[model samples]
Target: MTPIESQWIERLKQLPPKRVAEVLDFVAFLAAREERAAAPQRLSDGLARLVALALPAITEDEVEDEIQAARRERRASQQEA
Candidate 1:
């Protein structure tokens, strides 16, 4: 690993388990976001085409509802497991 990455790993190791997990989760989120951001323009162009076709039926409230529903599903699954 790079020096900076090794130092950050050491620092994370010193944290409590819960805090370490939080940091790891945030790191994972950032990595996934970066991956999405780095996707090929061709994929994004296709998404824009779809959006253009569907934007009239896809409202902001529907997006929010879908997010909330996903969160609820995750919580329920966590509780059950």
Candidate 2:
């Protein structure tokens, strides 16, 4: 596990049972929602809609720009290595 993630685990272990249950339930609920995208999502569904819509309208230029950025990152990593 990553250091940051291990730190979170240690912190959660200290919580009271009731609070731990509440946190676990909330995390499970979020993970389930993330697992089920591509089914119909509704706007009134709060965070579900927000996550579904966070990817804004994509244009050809925007896609090209992301491709260029990825290539640059890869090249930089290779050079550093």
Candidate 2, which ten residues in sequence have the lowest lDDT sum? 37-46
- Displacement of residue 27 (Cα, Å) in model 1 is 0.8
lDDT of 1 by residue, 1-81 (tens): 899999998998899999998988998999999888878776988999998887567689999999999999999999999
lDDT of 1: 0.91
- TM per candidate: 0.44, 0.42
- Scanning candidate 1 in windows of ten residues, the lowest lDDT window is 50-59
Q: In model 2, which residue pairs have backbone atoms overlapping below 3 Å?
A: none
Q: In candidate 1, which residue ranges exceed 4 Å CA deviation?
A: 40-81
Candidate 2 stretches greater than 4 Å from native: 40-81
The candidate scoring highest on lDDT is 1
Across residues 14-64, which tens digit of lDDT does each residue of candidate 2 receive? 998899899989999998887676334543466676788777778999999
Evaluate all candidate structures by whole-model CA lDDT and list the values in order. 0.91, 0.85
Could you tell me the TM-score of candidate 1? 0.44
